[model samples]
Target: MRNSPLHGLRVVEIGTMLAAPFATHILSQLGAEVIKVEPPAGDPTRSLVRGGPSGTFIAYSHGKKSACIDLSTPGGRAALHKLLAQSHALVHNLAPKAARKLGVGREECAALNPELVYCHIRGYAAGPQQDDLASNPVAEAATGVMEGNRINGRPSRLGPSYHDQFAGAYAVIGMLAALLQAKTGAADRHVEVGLYETGLHVAARDLVGVQLKTQLLGRAEREPHGEFAMPGYGAYLTADERWLYLLMLTDGHWLKFCQALDLPQAADPGLARLKDRKKAREQVEELVGRAIGALPFDAAVARLKAAGVGCTEVLPLERVLEAPQAQSPGKLREVAFRGLQFQVPEFPRHPDADDAPATLPPAALGQHTREVLEQAGLSAAECAALLDSGAVRAVDPAGFAWAPVRATS
Candidate 1:
């Protein structure tokens, strides 16, 4: 982190669940000092999976410090105000009303520190619809994306909590842009992002089609048994029953794909045009499938790559942990808890230390409460009082190093 870009910067995160936490986690990885303000009982996500230190919490909060501050109390608010006065950025994903009540609203915090990059993330954008409660699934259902992903005649959520993650990512973008603006002079410290609006942007292309009254083509309308928009451009089974995905959208891709698999159609000028190939979908898929099905998955991928055709074997999400591409150095970073370690892909890997070992693990609830409060300028007596009153909470400093998990059974 000494050589990292945001090494000396401080970011205060008042967040729970995914969106706000994820944004700060990325900043933590980028070398920002991220202090996650948790509630007295700790973030709910801490128990969302296997009880303590759940996977959801681990994935979203690596390398972050947790400080429990009860914003509902005057003592807590005073302490947070002191901390924000010296911070570079503050981010939260609470409801608009809840934020105002907590005194962490953009305006409130910005008044304390004008140059602070303040990010407010919520369910919906401003206006009459702003307060409607929404999380990932509700936002997706409100927008057209969920309907577009209908399966078996029922609208279904796409596997991941993509909307939450996307909102968090956009919030980071907004904050980084706002931070840059500060270097030029008086900066607009306020940045806002809404999950509902993020969903709108995710479905923007389809929205454009509707307004133009033009045909909107997408995988949702794919043919029965086809996983993508066109023949031979989807997941297929090989001789070993392993799934392989192919991407051949253009005329050149089609030509290369045919030659790669040694299909006789390579010599047919009549099938050169994409439109003609579409017209002959049934038989074309049959020939393509037969050729690919004759070879094992590895051989099929090799032949396709040799011809400059795009292809890959399809593995389930869990199998990605050991996938060669994912296992390669600089592709992932480690997160640990109770002496157990796991890895997650790191986006925009650290510049000077791509292969560096993980330096910090996710903190326990209120893990750094005492240390952070002291740094925030709270007197030891004040800190002790707040901790006693339950306005703040702190785990023993020794708890920083997680002990090995022991068998309970």
Candidate 2:
């Protein structure tokens, strides 16, 4: 832990669902001590669909201490205040109304601890649509990801929840930048990250192409048909029934690719330039596809490598996971939870590391109520009283539902 970059810093995570929790999970991987505050019922994802802790919850909450507190109660709110007073950062994805209702709104937290970095992750940034609620799929549509990554002119959602993952990554980046600013004598700041904005950023190259081509080139990029306009810039299936993608971004690569694949027409002066090849795109694709498709996957990849053309097999996720590099300490990690061992993807080890340390086990809901509160300077008796009063809770497989609490006289 001492070798990790964020070793001494502490973070308090207050949220439901994936985005904000994932962001803090990344921070935890970097050695920040993260205390996850959940409603007494636990995050909805914990029991999504068929019930029991879901894989998504385990994946995102690994290495965090869970504290179950009903923020609607005075005792619960007081517990949060105590936790915030000693924490360096707070992360949440609640809507404006929900945030204020819980008293962890940006202004509210700022008043509690001005030096704290308050990171907010939301479906959208500030705008007329700021209040418009969206889930991962909605964000995918809103940011054009579903519409842009298409097959046969029909929009399709990608296999993974990319928008949520991107939003989480952006939140981590924003918080890091804020921490850097604070290191230079600037006050701690509020960092905002939105799923829609992250989607746009992730699809930057496509968006930039639209701007440049329509404004400058006087043409729109052709609707994609599971391939690029450039013959060598997309995937092709081999004779052995395996798929591989090829890339030849420069003239030099094009020449080498043609020679290596034994395509005679590439030498014709009529197909000398990129514009000329694009003009005969169908013909070029036919020639290139036939040349590569005639070979087995490995043979095709070998020839492309020898010719210095970039090529890779279009493998499924499980196959890719079996790659040697993916099994390295920095990429894949083993974690134990409830007597079961699970292999999880890990962030690259921080630059300050000398060895790969074991990752923290994922916490069960409200598993750390007493320990975390004790760290926040609560006596054992006070924590017990809070639990007895229905303000704080310990892990209960039966689960607890959150109800609005009436203030005591």
Q: Which candidate is the best by TM-score?
A: 1
| C-alpha lDDT of candidate 2 relative to the true structure | 0.82
Please give, for residues 1-409, the per-residue lDDT of candidate 2 as tens digits: 6877788889999978888888988898888988999997788877774455567777888888999999999999999999998899999989867888989988988988998999988878888878767778787787666876776777877867768878888899899999999989898589998777787788788778787889887887645554566756788899998988888666677788888878886588777778788888888778878887799998888887988888888888668878777776567778786656777887776545564435778777898988999999899999999999999998875453324356899
Clashes of 2: 0
Pull out the clashing pairs in model 2: none
lDDT (0 to 1) per candidate: 0.82, 0.82
RMSD of each: 3.6, 6.7
* Model 1 residue 102 lDDT score: 88
Q: Which stretches of model 1 miss by more than 4 angstroms?
A: 212-228, 350-358, 396-409
lDDT of 1 by residue, 346-386 (tens): 76664456433255787878889889988978889989999
TM-score of each: 0.90, 0.89
Off by over 4 Å in 2: 151-154, 217-226, 349-357, 397-409
**TM-score of predicted model 2?**
0.89
Per candidate, the number of residue pairs that clash is 0, 0
